[model samples]
Target: MLIEVRNIFFSYLPRTPFQVRALEGVSLTITQGESIGIVGRTGCGKSTLVQHFNGLLIPEEGQVLVEGVDTRVKGEALKAIRRKVGLVFQYPEDQFFEENVFQEIAFAPKNMGVEGKELEERVRWAMEMVGLDFATLRDKSPFELSGGQMRRVAIASILSMQPEVLVLDEPTAGLDPQGKRLILGKLRKLREEHALTLVIVSHSMEDLAQIVDRIVIMDRGKIAFDGPIRVAFSQGDFVKQFGIFPPVVSQVASLLRSRGFEINPGVLTPAELAEEIRVKILEKKEREHAGSKRGNWSVRPS
Candidate 1:
């Protein structure tokens, strides 16, 4: 397993009136090279959970293991663990401190002790990976870019560290459709090319449906559902009860079924739903043709 959580429990405060249990005995295992999506309503501890994967938060009552090593074992090892699990927080632009895009992205590798030719190479590669033009944008101030570009620079900063597992918290929270698509496309390519394990904490059902192989729905600091994307979406009642919407395609299919359509329940994408509708129309036409032939035969019968 690339990551493992065993009987984990965490609280904001300990033994106080303000104490709130953020996580209650949540356990999960993520293998290497797998893409997992975490979805939940606001304040459901989704962000709290991914923070533990990189040692940002120590388990108050359980264990968090990365690559079979327990995170609680305090030492110089934690730094290496942090490098292995790169976290891009919500509104990552707010975390940028450098004056120029190049310095902002180079910060991580520099901190990791990469220098000289190695540092320049890592920064250039990271910028290119996130689709930033090195020669044109490197000297420009990070704050001068648009929101989408700033977000990409923030991501590139982490990529400079070259983490094995990339954990993104609401990566597309505030962006135009084109920006969202650009970031998602880059992430998909990175996962395929680098075999990077992606852990996305998002509320966007459409984005999750399109990218994630497995979906884990969290409710009230507990695992509500953990399975393949299709299986998780099939639990409509459970999902509705939690106030989370199924993928748009799933909802469309459900509505069509209610209206007496023979569409399959497994449709989870617009492309799949469109294809299903086309096939159904063809089938209906074929049935009408057969009916017309039968009526003509009856009229000719003596």
Candidate 2:
């Protein structure tokens, strides 16, 4: 396993009157080259859980291991884990502190002792990976860019670290449809070309459906559902209990089934749902044609 969480339990303000439990006996394992989505209602520990993946937060009990090394380790060991797992938080652009785009992306790799031409190349590659034009935007201040551009710059900064696993929280939040599509497209391409394991935390089921092969649904600080994306969304009613609606395609597919249409369950994408509907229509027509032929054969001397 690339990452393993062994029954971790965590809470805020420990031993205090206002303490709030954020995770309870939660265990999960993530493998290399897997794209997983974490979805849940607000305050359900989705963010808190992923924070442990990179050692940002240590559980009060149980263990979180990255490559079999305990996350609680100090110094270089933790830094190595951070480098291997890059996390882009929600509204990550708000954390930008560099004067220019190039500097912003170069910060991580530069801190890792990359310098001169090698650092520049890393920054350029990272920008390219996120669909940013290095030549046009390198010298520009990240704060001066549009919201979508800034988000891309933030992601590129993490990509510059050359992490084997990339974790993002609400990577597509607050963008227009076009911007969302651009970011998601870049992410899909990054997975295919770089083979980076991705763990995305998002409320948008539509976005998750397009990108992740597996879905991990959280509820009240615990994992409520863990399974294939298709299977998770197929249980529309069950998932709804966690305040999550299946993607539009899956909802439509379910509606069709409810109306006695032969649409299949587990339709995650629009294309898949459309294909199912088409097949069902064809089957209906074929059946009708066969019935007509039978009627004609049954007509004896009429």
Candidate 3:
């Protein structure tokens, strides 16, 4: 397993009046090269769980293992776990400190002691991976770019470290439709090309439906569901209670089914729903045509 969380429990401030249990007995296992989506209402411990994966938060009770190594282990081993798991927090731009885009992206590699030719190559490759042209944007200030570009630069910074697992927390929190599409596309490409184990935390079921293979739904600091996206989304009542909206296509398919159509409920993308509707319409039209040709169609005379 790339990540393993067993009966984990964590609190913001233990043994205090303000103490809040952020996670309780949450267990999950993520294999290498798998894409997982974490979905839930606010304050459901999605952020807390991902933090454990990278050693950002140590478990107060239970264990978090990355690549079969316990994160609680001290020194170089813990540091190595951090290097293997690159976390991009919500609004990653807030983490940026470098003046120029090039420096911002290269910060991670530089910190890891990569220098000279190798460091330059990694920076350039990371920038290109995120669709930023080094020649065109490297000299520009990261703060000056649009919100989407800034997010990409932050991701590139993590990529420079070349982590095995990429954990993104609300990666597309604030963006227009086009911006969301572009960022999602870049993530998809990264998963395909690099086979990076990705754990995305988002409230957008529609976005996760389009990209992730598995969905982990968290509610009230506990995992409610962990399964394929289709299965997770099918529990309409459970999903609704968690304040998550099913993907548009799933809702549309449900409505069609209620209207006596045979549309499958597993359709997640607009493209898949469109194709199913088209096929159904075409099949209906073909049946009508056949009946008309056979003189089996009847009409009432006025």
Please name the candidate that would achieve the greatest lDDT relative to the true structure: 2
For the record, the alpha-carbon RMSD of candidate 2 to the native fold, in angstroms, is: 2.2
Ranking by TM-score: 2, 3, 1
lDDT of 1 by residue, 1-302 (tens): 89999989999987999998999999999999999999888899999999999999998999999998888766678988999999999998987889999899889889889999999899999988989889999999999999889999999999999999999999998999999999999999898888989999998988988778898889999988888887777567778876678887898888888899998887888999999999999998898788788887644344
* C-alpha TM-score for every candidate: 0.92, 0.96, 0.94
Looking at model 1, the pairs that clash are: none
For all candidates in order, the CA lDDT equals 0.90, 0.94, 0.90
- Model 2 lDDT, full chain set: 0.94
Q: How badly does each model clash, as a count of residue pairs?
A: 0, 0, 0
How well is each residue in 1-302 modelled by candidate 2, as lDDT tens digits? Answer: 99999999999999999999999999999999999999999999999999999999999999999999999999999999999999999999999999999999999999999999999999999999999999999999999898899999999999999998999999999999988999999999999988989999999999999999999999999999998999989898899999989888998888888999878898888898889988888997898787788987644463
**Residue ranges of candidate 3 with Cα displaced over 4 Å:** 289-302
2 against 3, candidate with superior TM-score:
2
- Candidate 3 lDDT over residue span 168-198, tens digit each: 9999999888778888999999999889889
lDDT of prediction 1: 0.90
**Clashing residue pairs in candidate 3, if any?**
none
Q: Which of 1 and 2 is the better model by lDDT?
A: 2
Q: How many pairs of residues collide in model 1?
A: 0
